[model samples]
Target: MTETIAPTPNTLPARSIAPWLKFTLELGPLLLFFFANSRPKLFAPLVHPFLPAKLLEGESAGLFTATAVLMVAVLVALIVSYAITRRLPIMPLVTAILVVIFGGLTFYFQDPSFIKMKPTILYACFGLALLGGLVFNKPLLPVVLDNTMSLTETGWRILTLRWGVCFLFLAVLNEVIWRTMSTDHWVLFKFPGTMILIFIFTFSQVPLIMKHELRGDAAAKAPEHL
Candidate 1:
């Protein structure tokens, strides 16, 4: 019997993914993967049986293997970055750790809910960590966001407070999706919904941030007389 594999969809880039779209595109492989593997009856005579039916309620044939491949690819990317730059990466490693924890659970239990629940767990953990930092008089946001946005200690404090709250809100949203909505609806909204919420929330603070922003070269360069 001949075996056939579906072509990779053009959802996410093979090498790297943008921060915003990463949530959506990265899941593509899984959605394609499960759909292809889940109902062997659907593929029938066209595809081989090596791809068994889902192991659990939503198990995809070799679901574990598919998830592993995606995660390993991310690990490789990190390794390559270290080799080129010779610096320990924090965010990528954090992301990789999350991938391992969530993806591993999905595979181990053969439960689709594990995958669905990953975001809630991640957001909750992050929110708690940020709030903890506030208690310690530290702003965790600067740790994650300093490269992109630099601000004074006071700014960091406010930013951390805001992000901590946002993350908590996201956690609640995820819970609602998983508990009330269908798995498909939750999956569909996970990416776009998060992107919109985050984008809006993030930018909404810009005006306040600008108001509190300490003067920089732009301000200094203004006409002294004016």
Candidate 2:
């Protein structure tokens, strides 16, 4: 008699959500935040019944409203991702956690600065975490990238180091932008501007990824021990 083995998390089907859909899920919240911030008055009524009374009644109301919308949008995106993939990516999960914490603080204290600091904190934590992983010989970029491609240990190390530094750079950039620019400008930079920079950086890494890419037997034997 043949024994039927049940699938565990590690052995589960690999049919995750499409890349486009995943990208949309990640970008949707940021776009919503940008839109909500740009036209808070239009979105105020939609979120008014749900947010605290005080959050909608100040000079910072636009930011407050945008924060609330951002929080909700991020949660919704996570839910959709889970529904489709049966798992959440580590980076987005961490991002959602920061959004909730910082967003809550922003609402509770009626301060927009908390929300402004969220990106800085998120990027710095990711940067540190990635760099920290390398200290122990663990390449965590795979986890963040959801193990999309296979690479040699040397390749992983180089890629991970580059990403860690890039993330730190982005963290510093966020601080500078938010501190020096107007709220509207900051919001614009936060979404498309940030997204653009990441895309450019990612494309710039293509040659490195291609050069170090594992193939055939080598790819098959690539470690999953990130």
Cα RMSD to native, each candidate?
12.6, 2.0
lDDT of 1 by residue, 67-185 (tens): 45546555666666555445435656666677778877776776656766777878888899889998987667756652345455677678888898899999999989888986556
User: What lDDT score is found at residue 77 in candidate 1?
Assistant: 62
Candidate 2 worst ten-residue window by lDDT: 9-18
RMSD of 2: 2.0
lDDT of 2 by residue, 138-197 (tens): 989998888889988898899999999999999999999999988888888898999999
Q: Residue 30's C-alpha lDDT in candidate 1?
A: 43
The parts of candidate 1 lying over 4 Å away from their true place are 1-73, 80-85, 215-226
Residue 42, model 1, lDDT: 48
Tell me the lDDT of candidate 2. Answer: 0.89
Per-residue error (Å), model 1, residue 179: 1.9
TM-score of 1: 0.65
The prediction achieving the highest lDDT against the true structure is: 2
- Give the number of colliding residue pairs in candidate 2: 0
